[model samples]
Target chain A: MTTRAKQFISADQLLEHWQGHRNLTRRVIEVFPDKELFEFSVQGMRPFSTMVVELISIAGPALKGIVEQQITEFSEEVFQPKTKEEILARWDAETEVINHYFNQISEEKFQETFNLFGQYEFPVYQNILYFIDNEIHHRAQAYTYLRSLGIVPPFFWERF
Target chain B: MTTRAKQFISADQLLEHWQGHRNLTRRVIEVFPDKELFEFSVQGMRPFSTMVVELISIAGPALKGIVEQQITEFSEEVFQPKTKEEILARWDAETEVINHYFNQISEEKFQETFNLFGQYEFPVYQNILYFIDNEIHHRAQAYTYLRSLGIVPPFFWERF
Candidate 1:
């Protein structure tokens, strides 16, 4: 007789986890002093604003693309918001879109492979996790920038 | 008539995504110069070694605890590996354990909430994502430390 293994988490929990990261990232954006968000970099890496643009371009649209099965070309257009409030608005807007598109995905479709942004083909869940991973990666950079500027970032665990 | 949404990934795909982050993090650990891993810090935050210990302590045992329905107390024991090689070994060991225990999870259990490590009561999947999130957070710190030390971290997209 063979016993079955239990699942680790549900789709809803995955969405919650993704949102938690997004929430923390939004807070990180809020804490950045205006000039530093666009000016600070370590060893000539891109500024935090550019990183935010990359994130903004990817999160909502990528999920929508996956949901729609649309193989869209990767565009290089980065939204240049003039202020922190503008960035936050864009971020919040994208967050809503992410929720809307994410719920459109049912459990079984997660196993199907899709070419994300007309680029790499992987399981849809992998693509979504990439969104979360990329966000955390950039947020870490922002955190370092904050510490360098003598400002403390929000504690890592405060994801609510 | 109701329209149904498609799921874009499976539990297996989510595990793959989590493993990719782990793989990249392992590469980050390997690339660090011996002394810098433990000695470097920004604004007096904990060193990268301590961060790795936090990751090691949380991942394998956390999954095991979740799978076995055991609520273990969080331990503050940071492994003081004398060498980078030692750190890599511990990391590899934990990685193997993660794979072994992760496979033990079934799809249904993901929807059930578990108090991970006797704290942070959430669905098991959220807890696992927390593992990935925490890793990315610290790895980014290590990236900053590497840049500050005039070393380059592995490319963020090279998680394979």
Candidate 2:
């Protein structure tokens, strides 16, 4: 594959991983009765629904700001995740936002130096990896919730 | 709570979210048979373990960079997550690294813009939110794997 194709593939892999995890998590949620969605937990864990909202809130602006190269001003937006339909909508919105950012990257840009908060230094590419890394972290928890529910999610091997 | 107390509480909340989710995901991995951990998937999903590795590799550095405003230099190091033992070691190490940076943050830093991959711009705090957001994304996938195995990993709402 061409180098650019390869880069796109990385993004494709990320998107697949991101969406794949969500797909499975959704199954866990769908199986729940609505009341249980907010209230149930296997062990002092957040309810599946609460976690679902957690995922919903992070995508659009959180990733959006990073790709857009703007500083994030954290807010209660995350704490107040919208309805399921809204989460889905924001999820879709984040995809477009990410695609816009991903396609916008020139090879040179990836190599450029950028300051994170004024403390640590990083290249643009490194920041991208951070984005992917964080996704995997939380997805892992959702996996636990699924297992606790006794519903098998998608395979971990098929992430790519 | 006073405003500063509230902000601190929120920050703690975010950190706790990461920790709880990470723990839940790690548990999912522990329950998996080595074969299934690496091989099971339904459709367009990964082995779940790979996702964990990537998450482990990225979490500390990502947060440290953002909190410290450091520049990221992407290398094989960014993607080459270590073995389980190594990851566990690094995970502990990052806790210290992340703590140092978190303590160092000036409130102003949250509002300052950073060039994330030089693609889009965002405040540092948004990057923090993204960190939590992305973690949940991948953790959800692990939930899928747990269900597939006919094991219930844990409840989601019981985060500390």
DockQ of each: 0.46, 0.09
Model 1: per-residue Cα lDDT over A34-74, one tens digit each: 99998888885888989999999988878888888898876
Best by TM-score: 1
Stretches of candidate 2 exceeding 4 Å from the true structure: A1-160, B1-9, B73-83, B117-120
CA lDDT for candidate 2: 0.54
True contacts kept of 1: 0.59
Query: Which model scores highest in lDDT?
Result: 1
Q: Evaluate model 2 with DockQ and give the value.
A: 0.09
Residue-level lDDT of model 1, residues B1-160, one tens digit each, is 3332233345666677778888999999988888888888888588888889889889998989989999998875757677888888998898789889988886656657899878789777667777888899889888988888888889988978
Docking class for candidate 1? acceptable
Worst 10 residues of 2 chain A by lDDT: A1-10
Q: What is the DockQ of candidate 1?
A: 0.46
lDDT of 2 by residue, B12-71 (tens): 434544566566655656666666766776455566667666665555666566666666
